[model samples]
Target: MKRRDFFKKGTTAALAAGVVPIIASSCATSKAIIDDRKKDKWYHLGTGKKAIPERKITKDFEVAVIGGGAAGICAAVASARNGSKTVLVQDRPVLGGNASSEMRVHLNGVNSIKGKAERETGIIEELLLHNRFENEQESYPVFDHVMYDFVIREPNLTLMMNTQAVEAIMDGNKIKSAKCWQATTETLFTIRASIFIDCSGDGLLGASAGAEYRTGREGKAEFNETYAPDEPDGWQMGATLLMSSKDMGRPMQYSPPSYAIKYTHEDAHPRRSFKWFQDGIWWIEVGSKGDIIADAEVNRHKLMGYLHGVWDYIKNSGNFPEAENLALDWVGSLPSRRESRRFIGDYIVSEKDMTEHKHFNDAVAYGGWSLDEHNPGGIENISEPPSYFHYHFKKIYEFPFRSLYSKNVSNLMFAGRNVSQTHIALSSSRIMATCALMGQAVGTAATICNKKGVLPRDVAKNYILELQEQLIRDDAFIPNRPANDANDLTKSASLIFCSTTTSGDAKNLLNGISRDIDGNINHWQSDGLNAEVQLEWETAVEISTVELKCDTNVKRNIMMRKDSKNDELYGNHVPIEMLKSLSVHGRVNGKWQDLGTIEANRTRLIKFNFKPSKVTAVKLKLKDTYGAKNIKLFEVRCYA
Candidate 1:
């Protein structure tokens, strides 16, 4: 049954079971109350029946993910897939957060590092690739539904849209339940869970739970951050209002709305030049000095005015004949936010940690995006550059698990912009795809928390290695970390060999690294198609699953761009280098037997499962790629 269909027919489902109070009619007081209820219904033309509808629901789950953005989505999905009963609560009707239809910010990760993208894999990559086939039209609204389908299809996940988790019911220092207000149905949801992850960007749930947090820039002396302000201040980074324009075949007349603010090129910063104005301008923004969340509405109004004023200059200024035929197609009323509510965790990620590439024993995720911090005053400060693209990472840096959970609130954790990070560190790590990685990490950690009945701090302190291993097993890349899962039988193979050699050695597949990075190759590329890689065990081993991490060209991005850019840095379609067709075979009693074959594959991590068989040798027959002539594979694993 559809999850939301409980209101219609599946009301008896245990999770959404209704507990409405009906008149018992056993006493005079009850009869009097029933008479009043009947009188109230009679006032409504008797269509409302005998009782007032109860607009509240109480449910239980193992994990509760607050926010439906990239981070929250990843967190909820990971929690569910990792064996936790998870609930995904989104404030808006659609998912994707800033990248949603309301605010069309692109989902960016380690977009470019020295001209090559150390692109994210795992859930984020899977979502983008799903959009490649499902949202080929590249419409933001359609992409929203694509994300909706992805989350709801997971059997263990429950999605609640248009629900805002506003209040936290606390049990001492831990959050026992979240009082979420669903706007659409006027129903309040009390979601009880053992673990609570706040990825809502603004982090209302954590704040209500008394999670220690701070806002605005930190003083340089605090963390010795070169990019930090001279002294601490309440100057937080701002939000942006985006708009798109389309060109008509003929000249289109233009008029500015009355509320539009007047604009001239003379006052704006030189860096704010219209580079990709055909899509949406990113510099049209505003920031706050105090509480940014409280000022969201006031700032949103000003942003809409500024957006139209800029469009007026483009459409009617007559400064450029090229824009005469162009007309505004989409203007966003909602502003895409950047910074607010930095929760305090055991370890606060500072500028130097990212710049100097500080190693963390509990690193569970990695990021390489440039430290692109926007100007303090945002577009309001016309003299300053829109953003300072501070330091670009030459290589990826580790993100610690200690920076993801609350330092004071025992049960609260965070995964998005609200995570424990100095403002300078957030400048780089706030990218959506990077946040998605953090989400996946914390989500997986939530499952461990449930299994052991521990808090987030305990997981970081003691069970970190187990958490890292599970993350690697789930395909999340952590810098300087390699998988050493003892159950993987390929590492125990007596010999590993390849039929052909063109680039990397087949032995590298057992090295535990899944991707080539830092100018090093961990992959084995066949000189030609129809190649084979064989693993021989000294003794017959029982196995039922073989997994391969094939190349999907992580050096280039595949996320949907506003312009649908298909260039060297980005691809509009599937990666041609991906292994499209492959078959696994096993040798039993010195005779080869078919294990499994996949004709059309879509994900970078491909798996083949069959009945367990004891085989002395196993071979992988690599056939074709999506387009490339030769196929490349980074790692392989066999498990019973």
Candidate 2:
């Protein structure tokens, strides 16, 4: 019998006999297995006094996130940080899905909107900043390790690589457990969680639980999306195969692989022309009209062939002499996907919602990338432009909380491209950092579900404001949304004044807007490096935490780009505007007490925690910045 058949039969027999399979070495002797199992282990009748180990394991979590891409990683981290024991399961060996080293796609968000990046913040910002600090060399493989470190180091979170959440064990409409297959260990993992978040780009876990998901394009009539196709179709956006080339000291000979498809770019669309040839061409992509996930393996092979074919043309066509010394450095085998099963939700974000900036009361996150819809047939359709940038937004748009969780699957939620949005809306929100914001929103919601013992819909109906408050408190910017945390003592302070101000007022920090956007001045910029912001109360107040949202120059992109573009919109290194040092002093017994000091800050949200003390006044002394002459701060909060 085949090994798969043997395992199937073995599992059935073990279940029927009510025997626990000992998970020892598969090569262990029967006596050793029996000694471990206490006569309760499974038996293979034909073997001499035999017992075989079962390569299976069971785990439990408050939340289980399927997919370790940008969305899933943010979800897992947010959940774990917000008091939920979380597990992040990924099918690949690495954490970043499309942005992983395997596929060197740029980790893009609102890269450039009206010539400035309204970059994503919160957990996603933390990860990107972590990369900037750690991977100064800018190696893609090192970035994979940076992400791995980011997830692995988090408490209350478990990172499972090479593990795919293949099936969902449902109890009524709620997912009770996720049946996952870990290929590397040859063991199956059953992860039971109160809430399940499927950030998997293909959304296999949510689908297995009978989620109400729709594949293919939605017609214009359905969501009233002007950018949508006139009629519904099965054409999803294509997955791209990326490759990079390095210039060798000596000239490198080039030849096409056997499977390479012949490319005659004589009549190719002008827009599809390569801008940066040394970096991989984004147009080398392929898509399927139906079942993109099922056709992944086949598409990957074709993408490989197409990638080499394009490189062959560049090196040997004699059209460009700049590539004489260029040799292939990295060739991506995995085709980073664009669209698949979009799980339905309470609200389907359509084109008008984004273009007209329709506001949702339950807004949890925001996105501002342009509506860039790629042509259907990708490289094969050379006559058509690679992408149709249908619309651009001057201001960011709000993403509703209702569009995150499943409409039918009570405990199931999703982020990334799989979240419920019309294809038109997805054209903008599908960016990795944009999806990461959704992940943080859903992940925080999962904790609320576990805490209240309620479903996702219930949270939207009753606790949405609370959810928004928490998201903002965590430094996630919801466009046009101002945080009103009642517990924040900063609001009760009698006076808040800066030592010196050049641009914005010290009062703006208390306005609860974390970023300067939509033509609003929300930050307080100091005239010089050595400045003090004092907050005084009428009487002594107990405080222990001082959270300040400093400037990381969100206007410029900090995420890693393949081309390493360092223009005004895209920054290659850390933002010089970041505050490098800060010291806090509290007035206790009429004496200035040294609370704490942060020498070198690396994040936008700088936090200082010390022993709780009753103080009449608190003063924050700001020191040097990373590079800027003046220091800018978006928010400041005081809490016990």
Please give the TM-score that candidate 1 achieves against the real structure: 0.92
lDDT of 1 by residue, 433-498 (tens): 999999999999999999998999999988999999988888889888889999999988999999
Q: Candidate 1, after superposition: displacement of residue 467 in Å?
A: 1.1
In Å, residue 332's CA in model 2 sits off its true spot by 0.4
TM-scores of all models? 0.92, 0.92
State residue 580's C-alpha deviation in candidate 2, in Å.
1.2
Candidate 2 per-residue C-alpha lDDT over 105-208 given as tens digits, one digit per residue, 9 for 90 to 100: 88788764845546889999999999999998888999999999999999899999887776778899999998776766656678999999999888878877
Residue 100 in candidate 2 has what lDDT? 92
**Which portions of model 1 miss their true places by more than 4 Å?**
1-48
- Positional deviation of 438 in candidate 2, in angstroms? 0.1
CA shift of 83, model 1, Å: 0.7
